[model samples]
Target: ADGYDSGGSDEREFADAWLMRAHGHNAVDLDEIDAAEDALQETQFLLDDFAGLIDDFESQGGSARDLFEIVRQVVNNKKTEAGETN
Candidate 1:
């Protein structure tokens, strides 16, 4: 119901049609969006921590590319689960 008139079409019929279309597709949920944002933020924090670890590994003369790749994949998976695209 919140997004029912989001289209803001000047034509009444078009606005009504937009509302119908929103209902047909299920309107966006604000709570879900907030949850997704929270998840993404968490993923970012994880990435930051991994970045620090990678830097430490590299400083110790360890090849960190592989470790970085693994971390990248895990972070990507977390983002995907959060409904985000890289």
Candidate 2:
């Protein structure tokens, strides 16, 4: 969902792997491909925000980890909404 930053191949592979672990993951289980695509786009927005936080000289104002935590929350919330998490 990270905005399909990895694109379709990467996204498909991720969904396939996750489905395998979930045992018989299907279209719904993985979510509509379009939804995943949309989520990826949203994440790109967050990434841009994170990148902007970098100091003008490329120094870190803070660890990118904070942004990553937010990203994790976004994706986790979606998964929970779909009832697709442990």
The residue pairs that clash in candidate 2, if any, are 3-40
Model 2 Cα lDDT, one tens digit per residue, 38-71: 8999999988886676543246455556767887
Q: Candidate 1, which segments miss by more than 4 Å at Cα?
A: 1-26, 66-86
lDDT of 1 by residue, 22-71 (tens): 78678778999999999999999999998898899989898887876887
Model 1 reaches what TM-score against the true structure?
Answer: 0.45
Clashes of 1: 0
Query: Lowest-scoring 10 consecutive residues by lDDT in candidate 1?
Result: 3-12
The Cα error of candidate 2 at residue 9, in Å, is 42
Cα-based lDDT at residue 25, candidate 2: 43
Give me the displacement of residue 8 in model 1, in angstroms. 28
lDDT of each: 0.85, 0.74
